[model samples]
Target: MTSAAENILERPETARRTRLQELWLLFKENRLAILGLVIFVLFFSTAVVGVILTSGEDPVFDPALIRLQEKLLPPLARPNLETLAQGEAPRLGVYLFGTDDL
Candidate 1:
């Protein structure tokens, strides 16, 4: 019977590698894997950039500020001045995903 550390001491053919080193070695070995990793990073970065670009002081990006709105109207197909006059106007004057009644 032997401890795990003793087993490692007995093995001479294998080398110890940190997780990142092991992952890098595997990644380097596969071209498709590298491409997939690149694609995933690009997509994640784009989403982060999109959120940063679209966010404003209005708290639309801030989940803490979000609250229930009064009206539950279907989103307007296009910018309608009449909608503005009829009810609460959105920041962009159009409800991209419907807006508050106020």
Candidate 2:
């Protein structure tokens, strides 16, 4: 019968789908794996978005322009109000993740 033939043809696909569903259920049972998956997705999306947004501009930063005088500053080293008044701080934005000069 055509119904029997259709069932036979679909059996392998149904088995494969059941296996994939079982694997997904097993994966969801692990809290740490879920957290890691979330973190990975966030980082991956951030990198992809950053690349797209910066595509028109220079892809690489010229660290050589970063002066020796301005090197090795800690993160968020905001100038004091007095220093700002005196115009001592670099015109660049806040150092959110500290300097890369070690």
Q: Rate the local accuracy (lDDT) of all candidates.
A: 0.63, 0.63
Quote the RMSD, in angstroms, for model 1. Answer: 9.7
lDDT at 31, model 1 = 96
Q: After superposition, how far is residue 77 of candidate 2 from its true place, in Å?
A: 2.0
Residue 54 error, candidate 1, Å: 0.7
- Which stretches of candidate 1 lie above 4 Å from their native place? 1-15, 58-102
Clashes per model (N, Cα, C within 3 A):
0, 0
- What's the C-alpha lDDT at position 24 in model 2? 91
**Top TM-score model:** 2
Candidate achieving the largest lDDT: 2
Please give, for residues 1-102, the per-residue lDDT of candidate 2 as tens digits: 999999899876534457888889999999999999999999999889767644654433233344455556687765344534344344555655456664
